[model samples]
Structures are given as C-alpha cells and as structure tokens.
Target chain A: MNALTTEKLTKAYSTKVALHDCTLAIPQGSVVALVGPNGAGKTTLLEIATGLVKATSGGATVLDGLEPGSLAALQRVAFVAQDAPLYQAISVGSLVHLAEALNPIFDRDFAIARLKEVEVPWKRRVGKLSGGQQAQVALTLAMARRPELLVLDEPTSGLDPLARQEFLAHLMNQVATSGMSVIFSSHSLAELERVADYLVLIVSGEIQIASPLEEIVAHHRVVVCAPGDLDGRHEIEVIDRQLDVRFGSHLVRTRNMETLRGLDSHATTLEEIVLGYLRRAQGIRVLEEIGRS
Target chain B: MDIDKDSLPTQQDHPSPISFGLDLRSGVPTYLQLVQQVEAALRLGHLQVGDRLPKVKDVVSSIAINPNTVLKAYRELEIRGITSGRPGVGTFIVVAPPTISTKAFDQLRSELVTGWLRDARGVGLEDDAIVALFHSALSESMYLANSEGSRSESDGDA
Candidate 1:
C-alpha cells in the first residue's frame, strides 16, 4: 500500500505504558492532526514515527522508499519539533537560506514571501526576535523544506492569538498549494477547528479515534438543559457538565447528534470530544459504574 | 503556509464546470462532488463519451484535492466503464457507460441523504420528518447548483 502504516505498534516507558498496541493507517498527503492533552503520548508517538524514539514492539513504515531515520526518510519527512530550535546567532534570513540550500524541495521564494507577508523582519537574530517571531521562523524553515509529510509538534505554541492565526493560515495555504500531508498537534482547539482536515485523539497511551476533523465536530455535540432531573437519567457518561440550579449544560458524545433534539444547545467542539474520550479512558470504570448505577 | 491567491498559477477558465461559492458546506467528500458533476455533465449532454477528462493536476489545482484523489475518482469511473484511460494520455468518458441502472446512483444518493438524515434521526426525529428535511435540503442544493452554473458560464464568457 502506498500509505503510511503502523502495524501493531507498541511503545512503553518502563512500567509506565504509553501507546499500547496502537496501529493507524494514514494515507500519503492527507493533513491529519494528532491531538491530545499534556502527557497524552502525542509527542511520544510523533517522536517514534520520526525515529527519535524506537518502538517497543511493532513498527512504523513510511512507504517503500522511506524508513524512519534513513537519510532518505529524514530528507522526505520534515519534523517541526515542538519548539523550533535555531542557533541563537543565526538571523532569520540566513536560516531561511540555510534551510533552502539543505532541503531538496525548498521553495525559498515562497518562504521569503510568506515571512514578508507576516511582516516579520528577516535580519533579526534568533535570540533577538520575540517568541512568536521565533516560532514563525521555525515554521518557515519547515514549510520551506516542503517535505512529503510535515510533522508539526505544537507548531503554534508561544504565539499570541494573531500570530497563531497567521501561522495556521500560512500552514493551510501551503498544504493546499503543495499537496503535502501535515500532522500538526496542538492544544489550541479553536484554532484547530479552523484548519484541521483529520484528527487523531490519543489519551494516556491509546488512540481513541482518528477521523476527519469535521466529522469529529459533526458527530459530537453538546446539549444544555436546566440541571437537576436529567443528570440521573443520561445514558451516556457526562463528558463535562455543570448544573447550578440557575442553569445547566452537558457535553456528551454520540455517534449522531440527533440525540440532542430537545435540549437547549450550547457549544460543541472537538476539544470537548477529545477531553471526554480522555476522561473516559482515565476513569472508564467509574464512568461505567455511574452509567450502570 | 501562506496561500497567496495571486501567487499560485491560475489557469482554470472562469465559470468552470464546478462552482464553489454556490454550494453550502454539505460535508461531502470532493470525489463525490466530481462524481456528481460528471453525472450532471452526461445528463445535460454538455459532456459526451470520448470527452477527455481535464488533467488530474488541473482538476486538483482548481479544486482543493490531491492529484491522487482525482485519479482515484477517475479510476472508479473507469472500473464502472464510464471512463477509460489511455495511459499517459488522459481519461476519456466512454459512451454507453456500464449500466448506471438508476440504482447505481441511488446508493450514492442514499448515502449522502442518510448522512444528514442519520444525524437528525440520532436526534430522535421520526422517519417522516427526516424525509421531509431531506427533500427540503435536496431542493436547496439543486437550486444552488443551477445558480452557480449560470454564474460560472458568464464568467467563462467574459
């Protein structure tokens, strides 16, 4: 199959298990976002796929031409590490040139122009620029590489809201223009709602779901009702809910939102869907007992 | 990831076969859109058997899809005998494509309709209510498609 497939991949850290029997088949050139909260193994999984960390058992292969860590693989697969590491003395312009020269797929003109679009100065040293600017420069290097699969770990971290928006817009525009696959993991759910095509939700060490981001949003919804009588009757575990006799709302997951018919609806987002999954994975027994009781 | 609408090459003729803005975000896949567009072309006779398909690259460039995705759709059409590929030359629609048997289209139709209906059903709507909603939604979509086609036609003429 000309796809990225991980067969029975397992990873563990001593007695602390992280990613148990996780296997996912991701096609080439599909922008899939890996999302989970802190310590959710999102970073660990990305690290293994990049060959920075070895799998405890099973394996991840990237098509036939590439193997994790094979120079060919590294050349083709770009990793925008959580915090872009740049030599403190390097200027943004020089780093761009360095990246362009090193990467076979580098599109310097596009990268330079994108930086110009963000109005981030080119001559600023990595150490001299603000945090957001550093993030942008890091992102610019990765995008310029134009790899087949760009794995971005917290690509938007440390940026203000506006810079984050700019970064996301640029990331999506590049994906559309280049047909490159991106696996971007972020804590920013609202921003993720805007650009993600696919979502991978991992909690504690297992992938609960991976599907088109839109599908996740569409399938999961929240229904608000005056809290009190309904809590006892909800068949599905409450993902997160607060009911002050004055007002109440419940976030829950169902394959279909048609179950939400009569409730006064409130907000629904992938963030909720993911958090609920995490909660269940962590306290699945408690949730089941609640439901059974 | 800066998508400069102006920076990318723009070769598509205006009033293209597919209109973007006219459609609602129906949450349908692009291949399905291409499938529906081809069917409409055949029904309207704007396209005929032996008509060459626009290059996969061209289709991908115009629509936000991967080249492989366009190829996949064309491959499905070819398997159905609605289209044929001349290796390196492009895909061409074959006249008298394998029996579309109205039923062939029905399955795809039901799938799309059910996507919306299934969600409504999940919310506890009755079958009759879901059916009514489907009709309303389908009519809305058809109206949008027609308006979009005409708008694009004028753009092409210009």
Candidate 2:
C-alpha cells in the first residue's frame, strides 16, 4: 500500500492557486524527494499531506488509507516543517520532557541518546543552539515518535555540508534499522541523488513528473546537436531545449537509445533534469504573459 | 602448543574488510556503484570468498546513502551468484570472480603501454586526452558488446 496518496487534490487561495488537481502516490518504504522552484506549491502539498492545511477539493490519505489530520494518521505520521519551529525559550532537556509528556509513544531514551550522540547541549536553550543542532534536535523529537512515515520539508536547507551529511546519515541509519518510509523536500539535488529513490517534480503548482529516480535518470538524455535537428522526431519527448548560435542542447526523454544513436548525447544529472523542467515551465509562463499583453 | 590460530572462534567476528566510497559525478546509480565496488574488490582479491560484507547500517552510516541502496546492491550481488546472505549473520562472498593470471595480466599491461600508449603519445595526445580516448574506446566496446546481446547484466544501461 502507498504510504501517502492524493487524488485530484487542489488548494486554491483567494490570491492564487496553490495546487491544481495534484495527484501522486508515495509508495510505502520508499524515500521520496519532492523538488520544485520556490513557491511552486511544494510546501502546500506537504502541508496538506501532513494535515496542517486543508485542501480545497479532493483529498489525501496516509498509512492504510487514513485521512490526513485524522487522529490515527497524525499518530502514524511525523512532520518537520521547513523552519523546524521549536520553542526558543525551552531547554533541549525541557523540550524532550515536554514531548514525552504530550505524546504517548514518544521515546525519551532514544531522543536523549540521539541528542547526546549529536553533541547537542541538553542544558542550553533551543534558540541558543546552532542551526544544525536545532535541526537535529527537531529530527530527534520526530524520530523518537517512531512514526511509520516521516515527512520533512527542506530539512537540510540551512545546514552546512558536514551537518547535512551527518543528518542524512543518521536518517538513513534509522531507515535501515526501522524500515520506516520518508518523504522530504530539498533544493539540493546532489544531496537527494544519493538517498532518494523516488522523485517528484512539481512546476507552477502542478506535478510534472513522478517516478523512480533510476527510471528518470535512465530515460532522460541530453543531446547537443545543430538547431532544428530534433524538429520532426516524434518518438523523442523534448522536455527542454537551449539554443545557441553553434548548437542546440535538447533534454529529451526516450526509452529507446536507438533513436538517439547518432546524436552527441550524454546522461543528465538530477540537477540538470530539474533545471530543464523549471526552465521549460518558466518559458511557458513567459509566452503566456506575452500573449496576454 | 600447536593450536591453530586461524581456526579460533574469536577471529571470526572481525569487522568488514571493505568500505564503500561513492563518485556521484560518475553518473552511475548509487546502488550500482555499491555493486561495482564489491565486484572490483572481488576482482582485485581485496575481498575473498567467505568474507563478510559490511552490514547495511554500517554502509549507510559511512557512505550516507540510503540503506535500501546498499540492500539493493547486495541483492544484485546475490542474484549474480557472487554473494549470499546468512540471515542474522551477514552477507558473505560466495564465489571468487574470474581473475586473469599474473602472466596474462602483465602481458596485457605491457601490450597496452607499448602499443596503444605509444601510438597515442606519438600523435601528441596529452594525458587527459589519452584517458578520455581510452574511456571512449572502452565505452564503444561495451556498447558493441551490448548490441551483440552477450552481456547478461542490465547494469550497462545505467
């Protein structure tokens, strides 16, 4: 069963639409990476899935078809927001105690042990700690709940390279031992390249691609050829193209390598794929603005 | 006092002999990278038959990759009949990969250095160009082999 599934999910605000008919399924036991340009509704989708925000139409379900924000779903799913909001005034020790007092399943021992391992000062105020330490403390609390599915919104945004590696290593170790699923949104494509197996690309509040990372990397090829070389290729699905006076580099998705046999093609990195799609989306927006004007 | 130290029970639990490193710039999938490392270790005699592979947790902690990727690599190795998992014990190298004899290895190396290296250098190919040309030739050969349908592993596509 899918850990999380949304069908025709839409969230529209008075000013702008956040998500439009967004439908996707995150399989159980897979580490999914949700990526998009800033304000592309990644946060909205995550908020809706974690029950923090209500959808305007359609719905989402988590863990055995439980409705998001329901008591059961809340118990089984843990979320860490982008900022990892914590009580700045409270000590780490106090926060741990508070979490234990509030949640029946909170594993205080595990949280304490983890915090100690990460060298987080239990006596210091949460606000006084470094950004990395705060993030770790937040993750420790969430993990101590032993939730079936952990959803994180840009957990490594402000972390240094070492801290980010340590955080993800800790997370992967937990996944190895506990077999819990994860869905995290990150702007760092290189970071996601190693840990994330599932990929979800959102553009302009719509889902552009959702598939296994392996499939996406395998199917997408970047071909640099003369301009107009790909004009009539019906089999190649051109995702994005950049043209220069000398050459045109086309990012095309095709399952058959035979189609690109004679082309100067190479494999694309995850960052390239994400940027290509985002560029295409921005181009479309520009064209729409031009037409309207 | 002729006790066999090699047969002692205490010697069996040594940590895994090999650790994995990743080259993300290589564009190889993470799991495939793990698989290739194991294969390379086996080929170089660094990992021997019956040697235990690292635990999934250990690999994940060191490499900072998903544990599932490690598991997938071990699974692929098992599928290839190169390794086998012993449930609670750990995965072990089951078969020794085919190795070239020392004589043939030396001869092949000498031939490459004398023949291909000389020709490339004679044409004013620099170090980077020589390496790039070698890799491109290797890839072309692999591609031809793939088209001939002799390579059984699907990892070549990646």
Candidate 3:
C-alpha cells in the first residue's frame, strides 16, 4: 500500500489557489523529498493532508487508506511542521512525558534514550533550548510514537549543516530498522540528493514531477542541438531552452535515447531539472501574459 | 537473519566490516558511488568471492541513506554478475575479483593517465570533454566490431 495518496487535492484561500488538482501517490518505504518554490502550496498540501485546514475540493489519505487528521490516522502518521512547534514553558522532560501520556503506543524509553543520545537537557524549558536542540526534541516526540509514516515540513530549515545531517541520519536509522516511509519538504536540494530516493516537485500550485530519483535523472537530458534540429519531434517536450548563435540548448524531457542521437547531450542533475522546470513554468506565465496583451 | 561473520574466511582473504566508503560531497549519485566503492574494494582484493556483504539494513542504518539506494547499488552488482542475494539470507559475493598483479604495470598505467590528462588540460580540454571523447571512441570501436562480427556470421550462413 502507498504511504500517502492524494486525488485532485485542491485548496484555496479566498481568491488565491494554494493547490490545484494535485494528484500523487508516494509508495511505502520511500524517503521522499517534497520541494518547490516559496508559496507553491507545499505547506498547504501538508496542512491539508494533516487536517490542519480543510481542503476547498478533493482529499488525501495516509497509511492504509486512513483519512488524514482522523483519530486512527493521526495515531499512525506523525507530522513535524516547519516551525517544529513546542510549548515554550514546558520542560523537555515534561514534553516527553506529555507525549507518552497522549499517545498510548508511545515508546517512553526510546524518547528518553534518544534525547539522552542527542544530549538534550531534560530539565531545560523548550523556550531555552537552541533551535537545533528543540527540533531534536520535537523529532523525538514524533518518532517516539513509532508511526508507520512521518511527514516533515521544512524540518531542517532552521538547523545548521551538521545538525541537519545528524537529524537525517537518526531518521534514516529508524527508517532502516522499521521500514517506515518518510515525506519531508526541504529547500536544500543537496541534502535531498543524499537522503531522498524519491522526489516530488511542486510548481505553481501543481505537481510538476514525482518519481524515483534515478528514473527522473535518467529521463531528462540537457541536449545542445542546432536551432532547427528539434522542430519535428512531437514526442519530446522542451522544459527549458537557451539559444545562441553557435548552439541551441534545450532541456528535453523524454525517455527515448534515439531522439537524442548525435546531439551533445548529458544527463541532468536534480537541481538542474528543478531549476529548469521552475524556469519553464515562469516562461509559460510570461507567454500567457503576452498572449493576453 | 544476518550473515555469520565467524563462518566467513579469515581477514587476510576478505576484509571485515565491509563498507561503501561513500563520499557524500563528491556530487556523484549515492547509488553509483556505492556501486563504484564495492567494485573498487573487489578490485583491490579487499573483498573476495564467498565473502558475505553487509545487510541492506546495516548499510542504510550506518550510512543514513534510503534502503532503496543500497538496493539499487546491489541490483547493479547483481546485473553485472558480481553478487547475488540468497532468499532469507543476505547478499553474497559470487564472482572472483579480477586479479591485478605487477606493481610496476600499475604505476606505469597511472603515469600514462596522468601525463595524458596533463596534455589534455594543457589543450584547454575539460574533464567532461575528455570523458566524452574517451566514451565516444570506445563506443564507436565496440559498435564497429559488433557489426563486423555479425556480417561475418551472416556470410558464413550464406
């Protein structure tokens, strides 16, 4: 079964559409990286899935077809929001205890042990802890539940590189042992490149790309061809293009290698593909404006 | 069940505590890095046939990477006929490592590569350009040889 599946998941805030008919299925056991530009509805999608906000239209489901934010689903799915919010006045020990009290299946020993492993002082108030430490505490609280699926929204944006690596390493260790699926949204493509086997890219409130990292990298190519060489290829879609007097640079999206024959082509990296998609989306908007004018 | 370390050959034959030794900052894809490291270890005589590889879970937990990445690396090795997975047991090395002897030949090969790279760099050729040239040359020769062999076979049939 998929860890999460969304069908036509849509959301709007007054006049602005946060997510538009977003349909995606994230397979179980995948460490997926969810990425997009600012205001591309990444937070909205997560919020809708977690049931923080009601979707304008359509819906999403978590582990084993449980509706997001439902009682049973909440027990199986853990979400650490971007802020990693915790009660400021509560001591770290109290917070851990609170998690145990709230969740019937919470692992008390694991929580304490993880905190100790990270050297987070149990007596210190959450407000007094460093951002990284507090994030760790938050993660421990969520992980202590031993959920089947974990959703993190920009969980490491506030962390230093070392802290981020440690956090990811700990999460991966857990995943390896338990076979839990993780979906985390982050702006750090480099970190994602290392940890994420699957990638989900959102653009302009839409699902731009969602596939395994290897497949995505394999299907896209940066081919430098002559200006008129790609004219008749209806099967190929150019995601981004740059033209010079000497060469026509096109980021072509296709799995067929035969079409790219004799062209100076190279496989594209994740960052390059993401940037190309974003650039292409912006270019389309510009073209739409020109058409309207 | 995990592979029994005690049942394996001695340390001189196969290195204990097998590792991918991945360079996360090197910008190579993680799975490819894992594959290359395994091949490199085999080539260096650090891993031998009949040696048990680390379990996927162990690599994932130790390296803090997705299990699929390790699986992909292992799958690549399996496709290349270097390793095979045993049901209910861990993956095992099945193929013998290619023997590399004569230190003088190794040094000579490295010297030639270094000198060729220096000349290429002197000509303002980038690493990518050098790789592309080498790859094209290799592919062209292989393609020509395959076609020629096929033609000779057809002639014999006729």
Candidate 4:
C-alpha cells in the first residue's frame, strides 16, 4: 500500500486556491521530495496530508487505507513542521519524558540515543538551544514514537550548511536502518537530489511531474531546435519554450525523445527541469491575464 | 609476545567480495554510480566470477539510500549479463567484463593515451586537473553525440 495517496485533493482559502485537483501517490518505503517555491501550495498539501488542515474537496489516505486525520492514522504518522514545535519552557529531559508519557510506542532509549548521537544536551532548556538543536530535539522526539510515515516541511530551512548535512545524515541513517518511508518538502534542489528517490514537482497548486528521480531524468531532455521548427510539434508535452532573439534559436522540452529527432537535445538536471515547469506556469499566468484584458 | 585470537585472520577476514560506494557530489545518478562501481571492480579484477554481492539490505542501510535504488542498479547489471541474482540467496558476479582485443589496437590506444598525458603535462596540469579536464571533455562530446543520435532517430520516424 502507498504511504500516502491524495485524489484530486483541493483546498481553498476564500478566493486563494492553495491546492487544486492534486492527485499524487507516494509509495511505501520511498524518500519522496515534495518540491516547489515557497508559495506553491507545498505547505497546504503537507498540512492536509497530516490532517492539520481540511481539504475543501477530495481526500488523502495514510499508510495502506487509514483515513487521514483519524486518531488511528494520526498515531502512525509523525510530522516535523517547518518550525519544530516543542515546549520551550521545559528541559530536554522533560520533553523526552513528556513524549514518553504521551506516546504509547515511544522508545525512550532510542530517543535518548538519538539525542546523544547528535550531541544535544539533555540537561539544557529547550528555549536556550540553537535552532538546529531544537530541530534535532523535535526530530528525535518524533522518531522515538516509531511512526510508520514521517512528513517534514522544509526541515532544514534554518540550518547552516554543515548542520543541514549532519541532520540529513542522521535522518538517512534512520531510514537505512528502519526502512522508514519519508516525504519532505524543500526548495533546495541539491539537498533533495542527494536524499530523494522520488520527485514530486508542484507549481501553482499543480503537480507537473511525479515519478522516480531516475525515470524523470531519463525521459526529459532540452532540445535546441532551429527557430520556427518548434511550433509544429504535438508529439510531446512542451513544458516551456525559449527563443534566443540574438541567435534565433529555440529551447524546448523534449518531454520524450520522440520529438527530439532531428533536433539538438541534451540531458537536463533536476534544477533545469523544475525551472522549465516554473517558467511554463508563469507563461500560462501571463496568457490568462492577457485574455482577461 | 601475547597474541590475541580475535586479531588473527580467517577466511571471513579477507577483504569483502564486493564494496559499494557513491559520491553524492559526483553529479552521476546514484543507481548509475552503483553500476559503475561494480563494473570498475570487475574490470580491475577485484571481483571474480561467482563472487557474492553484498545483500540489498546491507547496501541500503550502510549508504542510507532507498532500497529500490540498489535494486535498480542490480537490475541494470543483470541486464548487462555482468551479474545474476539467486532469489533467496543474493546477487553474484556471474561473468568477467568483456575485454578489449587486438594487440595492434591496444598499442595504438596506449600511444594516444601517452600523447595525451604528455600534452597535459606540458600544459602544467596536475593529476586531478587532468582527470577533471578529461571528464568534462568526454561529457561535452557525449552530449553532442547524444543529440545527434536523437536527431537522426526522429528524422527516421518522420
């Protein structure tokens, strides 16, 4: 069963459509990257999946057929929000004790071990620790529960480069050891490229590409076509097109290799693929405005 | 002198049959990195026919990657006839990599390599610089070839 599946999930706040007709399936035991810019509905989608927010239409399921937001489902899923939420007034030891008291399956030893592994002071107050330390503490607490699925929202946004690496290393170690399934959203493509096996590219509340990272890289290419030749292509989805006014050259997504025939095409990186989708989204917005006028 | 039995070498103490690694900064896809590592080991004679590969679980846990990535890399090796899996057991190196033949061609290739090294040295290129330069050049040329191949194939289709 999928770790999480959303079917045409839609969420709107008044007139602002946060997410629209979004359908995605995150497989079990895969580290999936939910990628987008800051305001591209990544937070809304994650919130709905965790049941922190309600979907105006459609639904999301967690871990084989459990209804999202249900107590049973919530028990099996752990969420580490952007700002790792913990009681700042309590000591690190108190937080662990509180977690143990609250979670039936909490592994106290494991939590303590994780903290020690990261060298987080057990005697220190949560309020006094650095942002990285607080994030680590929150992660350690969530991991102690031994949840079936872990969802993180821009987990390392506040961390320095070295801290981010260490954090990801710890998370990767856990995933390797426990076969844990994870879904994390991040704007940092390089980090995502390193850790994520699956890619979910979301732009303007829509999922443009969702597949294994290797498959996405294999199927997508950038073709530098002779000017005026790109207009007649209907064999593949054109994510975006750029015209080099100085050289009269056209750059377009090959979508598949079929349209790349007789054209100069090159393999693209994850960043380039994402930028193409974002550019295309911008183009569509511009067209809509033009039509309205 | 006192000798510790634990320090003694045994059959199991020999170097592992297969050692897999990846460079996250290498820009090569993870699965391809795995495949390339195995192929390099085979070509360098570090691995032999019938050598057992590390279990999928071992690779995943040690490297902290998704299990499917290891599986995909293994599948690619299998497809190339370099390795085979035994279901309940584990994957094994089934054959040595194909070797280059023809002494004349080898001599010519070695001469070309020597000339390139000489030219690189003349330009005051260090070992790392030489490797980087070669890799960049190869990738750039391969991209040109790749696009050319695609263009021809599409033309044929049309």
Please report the candidate that would top DockQ against the real structure: 2
Residues A169-261 of candidate 2: C-alpha lDDT, one tens digit per residue: 999999999989999999999998889999999988999999988778777878878767777766689998874556878899976666666
Candidate 1 chain A has its poorest 10 consecutive residues by lDDT at A255-264
Pairs with steric clashes in candidate 3? none
Which stretches of candidate 4 lie above 4 Å from their native place?
A244-256, A286-293, B1-27, B41-67, B74-96, B102-158
lDDT of 3 by residue, B1-158 (tens): 23575565543454444776667566578888888887878887888887778877667656767777888888988898989988645688899645467897898799868897788889999989999887876755654464466456557767
* Interface RMSD, candidates in the order listed: 10.2, 2.6, 5.2, 4.5
* Greater-lDDT candidate between 1 and 4: 4
Give the DockQ (C-alpha) for candidate 4.
Answer: 0.19
Cα deviation at B51, candidate 2, in Å, is 1.8
- Write the residue-wise lDDT of candidate 3 on A1-293 in tens digits: 89889999889899899999999888888888999989999999888778788888887888758888899988888999987999999999998888898897899999999999999999999999999998899999999999898889999999987888788888888887788899999999887887898899998799999999977876787877776877776568888888455577788887555566566676668888988998888888889999999
Give the clashing residue pairs of candidate 1, or none. A19-A205, A170-B1, A258-B122, A258-B123, A259-B122, A259-B123, B15-B152
Model 4 Cα lDDT, one tens digit per residue, A1-293: 79989999999999799998999888888899999877889989888888899999988988987887889988999999988878999999999999999887899999998899889999999999999999899888888889889999888888988778777767876776677888999988887877888999888898888898876776677665655666576666666666455333233545345555555556767777877877778888889999999
Model 3 interface RMSD, one decimal? 5.2
Q: Candidate 4 on B1-158: residue-level lDDT in tens?
A: 23554564432545347767778766687888999999899888889887878766667545656667788889999999999988755688889777677897889889868898889999899999999877767756776676577677658878
- For candidate 3, report its TM-score: 0.82
Docking class of 2: medium
What would the per-residue lDDT of candidate 1 be over residues A7-33, giving only the tens digit for each residue?
Answer: 778888887887888888887667777
